[model samples]
Target: MASSHPRVLAIVLAGGEGKRLMPLTAQRAKPAVPFGGIYRLVDFALSNIINSHYLHVIVLTQYKSHSLDRHISKTWRMSALLGNYVSSVPAQQRVGKHWYLGSADAIHQSLNIIEDERPDIVVVVGADHVYRMDFSQMVDAHIESGARATVSAIRQPIALADQFGVIDVDPQDPTRIREFLEKPVNPVGLPDSPTEVLASMGNYVFDADALVEAVTKDAANPDSRHDMGGDIIPAFVDEGTAGVYDMIRNEVPGATDRDRYYWRDVGTIDAYFDANKDLIAVQPVFNLYNEDWPLYTGYTGLPPAKFVHAGPGRLGHAADSIVSPGVLVSGATVAGSILSPGVHLHSWATLTDSVVMDGVQVHRHAQVHRAILDKNVVVDERARIGVDHEEDRARGFTVTDSGITVVPKGSHVA
Candidate 1:
């Protein structure tokens, strides 16, 4: 039985130093990094929470959080008249002089927010994933199951189980979590499906009392990692109060079958690039045009994208790409790419299978292939990036093992 509109407080964890996505994470927090032409990674989490009508939300930030804080403050303003707010709470060393040790410790330090809000249930989610979920339904499942903590789980291949924290479900009770294993070398498959396992999505709903208690206990343990996945959740599993909410059952209003269960943890350069590419598909794996549940962000009031120079050998064309507002593809050929707001591609420049972020300038005759250019990057005339691995490395640009070149923010490539 679902509780009739229980007081819910959502806490978005946005503090991780994304070491894998360097240069992009060089100046900004991972969640604050630009995504999908127009939005930040944290926007997805905040959008879902607000779309689900969970109005009272606080974003927890640490570790180079200035950009993240600015984005949240400017983009996520809710009406104060309705007593609803979407605010970013930075780590203030409330417990002591130390910064946040881990995710659990971050929350433990900011328990004052929870206490002040006095919410019945807390919705804790990560800020670096691309997905849409009806968390209200998860909250209902949490209340109905009578679990102290409920983890949102998605089915992943057993072979790739070592990459994620796998959840072992009780054979007798599908909702009950039998064990929580963090990236185990040899993982157990699901009870019904031997080839698939329930992988934790790092999103959780906790009974307010249970959450506070678990974090408090973990803080006292000397050997604890002070992590929600490593310490707090395991304690709930031991108490038999940890439940699993299958993400497959989550139904959004305008979601299609193709993108119904689409969730991507864009943790690495390759994964992040792939996730953005997923949006530009003919039939996108993750549809962003769903008007029923719109992805909210701070919109720059700019005019529509413009294309010019239709003469021979100077066609300003963008095929199979997402071109955001204020982008001018002047005599350039953009294919299989994303041109973010205010990007200007000059004559004869070719951008293919790449992501060029806001305010970037790809000068005349420059070519960018299979690369990610961060904000305000200036590619000088005829400059070549992502073409030669040796040259890219020699230029001090970060090149991935998969050969994706990453040009950092505000860089001028000559």
Candidate 2:
């Protein structure tokens, strides 16, 4: 029996090596990659968990996690006096000589943490998504349903169900999962909509004891992939103990109706670019100024952003953009972009619809349009990015099918 006030623990999985988001992810983990200016991809998940008032968190890290670990340590310092903590746990090959085989394996290897804390309910979430969710609501639903595990799902078009791990709900009980289908062809639509299907969001809530037993049982199967979404959830579904939690129902404080339920899986470079663009809109699709549910990140103690040169052509101006602290726009025009901390745009430089990371330098007359520049990247004088796809490709830059140019970290575009 689950208590009404069950002790809940959160586990943020930040282990996957982001091969799709290259150059930017070259030296850092995917969750460590900067977004919106100063916030890392992982911050959104941690912040949401914290804001939900579940303070006991352990970030699971693997694959070049130094940057992610550092950010968690420095930015997520919970009050040690109160025995609350946000600790980063790296892969130590504790279960065996090999590293983590999959997401489930990652958890199975770190069962020691769960055993130590002995929380009643466990919340598992991916580190690199952009959204605001109140897991407390989901926990309540899970307890009410008395399900062994609940998978959070966002409704997607039935046509696109083949691209995601779709959950077929019990027609009799909409909350219970009938089957956990992975990218199935011609998935059945919802009972009401008939046009949408529930797609797994890679977030789950589990009864702590149930989770421990399931993972321990899964560890013995040599054929299992041990992935949470692909294997474990399906096993629970087969046992008739898995339920689905619709994400649309979980509301947060200070969320605008327009931007509510705005969840983005920024797995690729193009998707990542578009997510940033959503922040700079006139009425941004994703509002960052929601005081009741503010996004938390580390402060670098930098000076305020400065804009100078009001003269005719040398005017420093930015419109419909997000400029972080320590950014200097000295005689430049920025439109529909995000400038990270310590970025400097020189005189006559023009940046349009791009995401510029920390300490980047855009020299005089450089033009960047529909692009993503990684940390410390330099755009030399008169350099043009996204102006020519062929030229960008020839220069070893990545140009996606969507025509978004990506300059690698520390690269000089000349």
Candidate 3:
């Protein structure tokens, strides 16, 4: 028996050209960037939408979207009998001979989808963030509040408010948004909690009719930047119809106090590296083993990860790490790291506090620490990375100020 549900549509913005995550995004779109060894960044957004029972989704993609398109097509197939699908819509230049000018422009160009689906509500989200959210709850809140639009907000420390788009709710009406601040040097705290500011998580729910009208109007505005956060959201806030959904109220089935509300914007290399390392923690900030709200991804049918002993009391060992399927660790030591599928750590190799992507190989006696190795990277025997910043830089590798070395895809470290 089918239960009654609203006609909802989800739009995932996957077109971001992650300039900060260079080398990694040089080939694939930002959403196509791998995370936690097994899943891409887009997987988090799509999985949340699916878990919330929103079956109709449209992933809007642009710059280097081939892998993103392929991943979505292969991994997100829904039942045809139920009229469910997860489609990837490229920059078709339907309105004009131009790619997506901005987030608002993407929606403006894709208004035909809204007309076709005729959904009552539209759930829009960014594809590059890592979080588990129930958009249905936000939708319900939007309907009840009689607001035209609702944006999900995560509470962040007052000190870090400048890094995000801050949302200030109305003093009288706590749920209504009074202002939308973009990376403000000094942001006012929430009405309830003065120590924290509500930052936009780049997730929104809007009435279908209101959204279509807003985007259409934005497209015609010559002065508008055609952005969701900067233009569309500010317009809504000025209209007094934009409400805020505090994420602290969103409760997941298997959430814990420590891991709950774990939303990370892994846009920059350092942030990306930190988030990946968060998984290998003794008590991870984000729990991937939550069967109640599972993170879905494409399966490669690879064999289980294998570890071999080197004999004579030497052993292949790993601690506080996520070793993906098809990984082979023979006489190697891995600690505080993530090894993607098909990675090979040869004898006498040692890796610490690093991320090794798919098909990467660490040759004998190689040492890697506090580094990110892109797909198929080969570290030659006795090659040391993250040991000397000057050497890493001299070899054309990217070394961040925070002391994290990033090797580009398929590169050889000697």
Candidate 4:
């Protein structure tokens, strides 16, 4: 039986090799990417933890974590005096380790600290996503199920399901997942319904003792892959009972609205761009304005976003976009795009169906469309970027056939 007052600890995995979201993630980690106008990608997880009343949060960081570390220090400086705190535990070469080889290895190296905390449950989450979830509910479900681990599962369209880790569950016992397929070519045949598949949300709650034991044991295995999903969970599941918590609307009244049940894995540049665009929609599926469940982030201390010389006739209007604080859009027409903080748009520069990141300066007469521009990029005057797919490809930029050009951060384009 689980304890009534379980001290839950959240271990956030922020040490991913973000290969797909290149340029933006070339220098910084994926979790530090700006999203939804003002907030970083990892803010979603931290807010969820704070809202759920969990104070002890440990973010495990590695692989170009300078920007991520800075963001955590600036935004998440909680009070130690009040017995609540959030801290980053970077990968140290203390254990004769160069860098965390995998998720399990990261935790394995940190077992001493985890065991010292002596918490009842350990909630592990991937930081590079945009979602609002009450992790306490997942913890409660884990206790109720009396399982070693409880994985949060979501239903997705079958065609896209194979791109994620798909699970096979028993009809009689929905919680009893039978098999795990990591990005299968054909996941439709593995699920009960042909149209939908049960996908892992990468959010997990584990028994603290079981987790520590698994990590220590798995670390000793010579031929193992040393990943949580690849080895730990599957090994524990084969040995004992592990449950699956469906990503359905929770029973928490006035809290778990249907629209609030949103989770995204923005692992690729296209996915990251699309997630940002969703926030600017009129009736966005992922509502950032839900006051009842406010998404908390760092205080900018800056004034609200301002738009100058924006009117119908002037043609310098910002249309269907979110312009964040301290932005100066002067005499430029922006349509279906998001402009992050400190973005300066000179006269006649047009942005259409794109995402311009923080500190970007669009010079006069430049046109950017169907693209994602990283931070601090300077678009020269009269330069037409993301104009045509063929042109962008010829210029050594990654322009998909659909005309989505991805400009990696800190890249120079003449």
Candidate 5:
């Protein structure tokens, strides 16, 4: 039995041209960036959708969406085409040369398609964040509270609150949002800390009728920014029907406790780097190996990751690191690193606290530390990277002030 669950649908926004991720977003959408060795950035959202029992989903895509399109087709083929279960909605040129004028416009343009489905609830989301949540719970909360809309939220550090849409809610009633501001000039303070602020995760749940009305009305507002957080939320907040859901501490099955739910917005290079580093942490905040709440994506039938001459007495060794299938460490030394499939670390190379994506070849005697090497990149022999921030940038690579170098995909080092 499918159970008497609500007819919920997910609308994932993958349209934004991620200028911050740079070189990485040069050829692919932000959501299509490779993550956690085996999955794309979009997989995290899709996994949450399926796991949350929102069988019906439509990914709204634009702006360099070819890679995202191919990825969705390849991995999400299990979805039905004839039904309202699952599909990807790439922005077609039907509306003239102007592509997705804004996030609100994307939905406004797709209003007809959404209307055809007649879903009970529409779960709006961004494809860039990395986290997991059961949408069913949010739906349950929405129904019980009888709110017009609900925004997912999390507590951000005091210093970083200005960078996000700060939310002010009654601490007593965590569900009732008192005020909402989009990247406010002076963020509201948190109870735990006089300086910290609670920020919106940019995820939302709307009653089908409420969503249709809001999107239509917002579209007509000539001065509106055509963004949900900027225009729609504030409009509803004035009516006092908008609610808040603490995604960081939502009492979902897999995510509970104040500190368990890990949510990250990888909108900037620093944020992206921090999120990737979270995966390699001891007892990672985001649990990828949880079988009960398994993540889903299109599977590529690659051979199992292997380690030849591993363990003691071998020229190469990996300690406390995840070596994906098809990786050959050879005589290299890797510590606390993530080596994606088909990575070749030449003999005598050393990799520490780094993420080596698929098909990256580290030449002999080279050292890579606290760096992210994109797919198909080759580091020449004895070439030093991530050692000096100034030197790495001179070589056409990005080096964080902390000395973490980022080599873009298919980059050729001279």
Candidate 6:
């Protein structure tokens, strides 16, 4: 019994500093960081919204958002004649002369956009997650349940509950959220599955009036964190007006059984690297080639990738990898890696289990393994990376605890 169509406005939160993802985030915001060779992290969220037929979108941005702003402006252009737009709204300090204190504070400050649009339901989502979801289904469930706020919940193992905001549901009402716990050490398991807990996906569908009232009240509280997951959600849970939308129940077109519920929060270096590596698998857990629910981004006009030269001990070949456009694998042996656009590999260069970003030049006999080379990095002849942690750290490069060496942007290896 849901309405045929409701006035929906999508708000994407893209303001996190992403301090945990350093070096990669040094030059741009987390959402602006390139992913899967061509798309940015924010592209996943925006694609989902657009694919769901929600065209009126506003991205709230802060903390080094120049690249993020430019991406949205250039790529997400919608026809203004049709009343569609994808705008990036920065912190304007409309209420005070200070920056956004938290997520709720961000929305509280940008009330003007919401008021101007006058949407009946506001769908707010985070910018740094990789997932595909048809949010229109969640909206229907929210309307049917008559909840003031609806949070998208994903089933995560109980052992990993400490990593997220766990949701405790009422025993009698499976849809009603009993409590909201932030990174709980001992989380309550679901009724049917003892080893699984419902974790908030940081996506919410809010009744427009409820959202306005919650954020407005939270703004006046002196001790509140004013975060969406930390403050606004807990307030609605206290009022028994918050419902949970099971992500497992939401169906997206062209989703395989192996990738139906695929979602990753690439918040750290290892996590980001692992997520990128996930694409090279024979059967990726998160498939990128699903054309039915395609992931959209800015199109580059680069030519197709090329592989040249076939000499003794110097074969230009790549196995189990994704090589983007304009990449030239010249007499290089690439295995289990991702080569971004415009990467040029010289003769005898071997890259294994690594991510080479755009415009990188790997010289002859250089060996790269389990490493990330940022944009415009040049590896000198026979230079070794991800081979020695001590040497890498001494050379001012970052070496994660997992031993993933990262060469920052425009660095030359010798």
Q: Per-residue lDDT for 46-101 in model 3, tens only?
A: 99999998999999999899999999999997777898899999999999999999
Q: Is candidate 3 or candidate 4 better by lDDT?
A: 3
Task: State how far residue 77 of model 5 sits from its true place (Å).
Answer: 2.5
lDDT of 6 by residue, 241-347 (tens): 99999998889999988889999889899989999987878889889999999999987789999999869999899999999999999999999899899999999
Residues 1-414, candidate 2, lDDT per residue (tens digit)?
Answer: 579999999999999888988877889999999999989999999999999999899999998999899999999978979978899999999989999899899999999999999999999999989999999999999999989999999987887676578988888997899999888897888888899988998899999999999999999999999999888899999999998999988889999887899988888888899899888777788999899998999999999999997577877999989999999999999998999999999999999999999999999999999999998899999999999999999999999899999998899889
What is model 2's C-alpha RMSD?
1.3
Q: lDDT of candidate 6 vs native?
A: 0.93
- lDDT of residue 329 for candidate 4: 78
- RMSD per candidate (Å) reads 1.3, 1.3, 2.2, 2.0, 2.9, 1.5
CA lDDT of each prediction against the hidden true structure: 0.93, 0.92, 0.91, 0.81, 0.79, 0.93
Q: Summarize candidate 4's per-residue lDDT along 1-414 as a digit string, tens digits.
A: 349779888889988868877767878888888888788888988888888788998999998999898899888878999988889989996566467878999888788778788888899988987887878888888898788888888887788775677777767887777777767787665345678888888888998988888888888898888987778778866875768888684433234343556778888777887888888778786778777657777766767666677555446669898888878878888998988888888788898999888888888888899888888888888888888777778877887545679776755666
lDDT of 1 by residue, 1-414 (tens): 225779999999999999888989998999998999999999999999999999999999998999899888888978899989999989998998999999999999989999999889999999999999999999999999999999999998898788778998888998999999988898877768989888999999998988988998888988998998888888899999999999988999999889999998888999999999999887899999999999999899999999998677888999999999999999999999988999999999999999999999999999899999999999999999999989999999999989999999999999
RMSD of 3: 2.2
After superposition, which runs of candidate 3 have C-alpha atoms over 4 Å from their true positions?
Answer: 1-4, 191-195
Q: Which stretches of candidate 4 lie over 4 Å from their true place?
A: 189-192, 251-258, 310-313, 411-414
Error of 5 at 385 (Å): 1.2
Q: Could you estimate the TM-score for every candidate?
A: 0.98, 0.97, 0.96, 0.94, 0.92, 0.97
For candidate 1, the per-residue lDDT at 107 reads: 97
TM-score of candidate 1 on Cα atoms, chains taken together:
0.98
Residues forming the 10-long window of minimal summed lDDT in candidate 4: 249-258
